[model samples]
Target: MVSGSNGDGVRVPSASFSRLSATNVLFGWTWPQLAVGGVGLVLLVIGGAAGFNLPVMLVGVLVMAYGLVRFQGLSLLAWTYVWFTWRSRLREGSNVWSSSPLETGRTVGVLGVWSQVEDRAQVVEGESVDVVGTPWRDACYLYDPDKRQATAVLTLKVEEWSLSTNARKRDRAMALNNLTMTLASTPGVVELKETSLLMPTSAPVPPDLDDPDMPSWARGDLAELWAMPEIATPLANVSWVSVSVNVDRLSTRSRNMDRLTERNRVGVLLGDIVQNVVAPALVECGGQHGSIRWCSVDELRDMIRCVSDPAHASSQRKVRRGEPTLSYCEESADGEYVTLESCVARSWWVTQWPDRPVPAGWTRDILQGDRMIALTHIWRPLSMAESEKDLANKQSSMLQRSRLADQKRLSRDERRERREQAQREAEQDANWPDTDHQGYITLFAPDKSRLDDLERGLRMETGKYHLTLNGLTGQQRKALATVLPLGV
Candidate 1:
């Protein structure tokens, strides 16, 4: 493997040792483009046969070029329209109350204390329900009140280890390979809806640091730490991996089944997956499964209240404000998104993917930094046929762009970029067998100044992989919601 120096002068393994060739053509013109070109050709021939009318021939030529250049855009538009129409028709035909159960469903309320919820069913009065009985069980479930579909969510902590060295690199690779295999074996059994790794800023002292029994010297040090700027303040590296799965497929129950029965069934399935699949996988990766529990109603309510009103969260003097009194949020001027709790966060979408093949655990650096960060990955499964079609379309687009670059006699940098993109696409077609993946990273800090520092750290860390992150802007709240284990 080739090694390169990072901004800190630390030697890190390069993404790939050898460059892949991008001269091969994997796909040609798509069917839609061909059909449009055929029509344009016919029009051009007719105009020529009718004494070569300049306007008609010129229109035909323009139409042909448009069909060729904007083929992907037009095709995507058509596909989107067809998909919406089909979904609308299905909703109309079904007796279901809403188009999507996730959007309209009421949250599955959790009762009892955090310590009381366990992996096993808890017998209470006349009903038996599995409780999410652990402090680490930061998962929440959303229940469709109408359809009775239950979606269970659990956010497990992610552990970060060094990957720059050879031994650590090998370990990272094995862990990732094992994870991929485990996920693939599950088939349609469970869905890894979202995986988030967050590193929020650490508090200077424990919540109980104000005890009178504390020594004066220790108290002085604690106070100094607290007074330090967030950038200088040590960060608590916490990584959370949230997984969401639908519970309807776990059993052969009818759609009219009782809500309690459905909830119990889902709870059992989620617990089993955690104990059997998820926990084992983490153990194999040299990490322990921290907590696995369904999210409580109180926690969900608190989150909703905080997101809705930042003032309630930011207020120091707590007056009784009905339910969800302990709010934590800071809203932007427009009030679309909020700085949640003590963390000033901004979500980022991966705009530019790495052109080269990086080590499997390259994300370790991104997750482990002096500043708090959360990285979320959402994978949408696609059938084999769909994957093939999508790959073909991408290959064709890359080829078109490369040809265009050549025709335009673009600069060496531009040409190199096109070639690298094509090479990366080809590599993905050959190697990646998973579903379509979308990645988001959220950086958090105690305040705006710390947030800027965290952002800078993120940029420097991601620069090692040649990746670019663009802020989600107005969609920060939505992005944050995805990162949290809300099952929304």
Candidate 2:
């Protein structure tokens, strides 16, 4: 595999097999599975001691094996909890109880007929007079009454580039490295919660029969070519990046403040991050960053409608519809645990990360599939002191594990490897910056059949990078919001 240097000058492999060790086997089993298996094993032992019938002993063994193999008891438990919660909501007969964090926050009711200000220069004046709260250059800002927080969604335009030439490839790689470093260093740049890259399934090109440059003979050929169903036409791809910044967490004030004050403060912070950090970082990376626009109430409603109701998407009727004033979303099904959506969506949690070094663009495959997918990376910043303490505790835990492994006569290689890893982590704690990150990917489809097809494609894509994804069964609604740019 080809190798390249990252911002830290570390040699990164283009692709490689992930590291496999004994610890992986233990980690593969969830706690619930382990507990179930343990109970089954105890039953088997008790049955054997009492000289119980062979059938009873066989049943116990089978239960133990099933628990070890399926590891689905936990998911079932989670679904049960969701079922009870839904029942309670039904009993209460109030919409106040919600599973989604997006709906739990303060209700401003629905503001109608919000409009986007196309001219960047008029943003400030627009906010002061006509706009609802604080007007951002690119994004719309809203105050969440429940959380006392301000949320903004910035739409960034991703510019496409060619990498066919070696020189172009090298330059792009360097640009990506620089962008990565910039993001890592930027303050208040927490997480990229969700990114949506959409490409139309089919595009049709009409023949220009009236063009004077075209010969009469060529016109018939062009018309025939345009009519051919076998030919594929290319369409422009659109991408949106959703990010959430915690206004309450960023504020210095201890007491509750006015909604307008909170809105303005959060708005300024979002603008600075976009302009000073995101925009400059993209420019250095041989790419251009677009204006950071806020999603107007109308825009938000349209988005929800498009995602929830696929008919609107397929018919393309909603494309030209002017943004509506207010929008509300409701899930179509409950308790079955698979189809959870304001429209229809399936959420997946990243169960495993690549264990070995991979190219910087390892995630590119995620966007290549035919289905609409949203990938989210949630980063939680850790203070230097907190990181150091956490590392020290981990080191202590590793040492104890190593000792236990030695006493149990486990593989010497595995024990030695654990010691080495602990040592490396100690060195890293002392030298490298600390950041905790979580990632989620959500797949949206029009129906169950489409969702199933997309899920298979996604699994194949993720497998290529040595990553693992597990469906977030009962937590689909929560996971969906978490993956969206709506700072839940």
Stretches of model 2 off by over 4 angstroms after superposition: 1-135, 144-148, 161-190, 201-205, 208-236, 251-260, 285-295, 309-343, 407-431
Writing each residue's lDDT as its tens digit, candidate 1 over 1-488 gives 23555556545445442222222223244576677777878889888999998788888887677555532223433444544654553455321111223422332223211111211212111122334422223344554343334444443444455524555545544554456545544533434554544332323344446789999889988777767655344444433344445455554334333544545556555556566776666655545355433444444454333333333333323332232322233335332234654446677767555656675556767766555566776655444455456556655656576676665767654565556546546645655434546677876666777777777777887887777665644445556656654444
TM-score for each prediction?
A: 0.56, 0.63
Query: Which lDDT values do the candidates have, in the order given?
Result: 0.50, 0.52
Model 2 TM-score relative to the real fold: 0.63
Provide the RMSD of all predictions against the true structure, rounded to 1 decimal. Answer: 10.0, 8.4
Native-vs-model 2 lDDT?
0.52
Q: Work out how many backbone clashes candidate 1 has.
A: 8
Candidate that would win on TM-score: 2
Range of the 10 consecutive residues with the lowest summed lDDT in candidate 2 = 112-121
- Report the Cα lDDT for candidate 1: 0.50
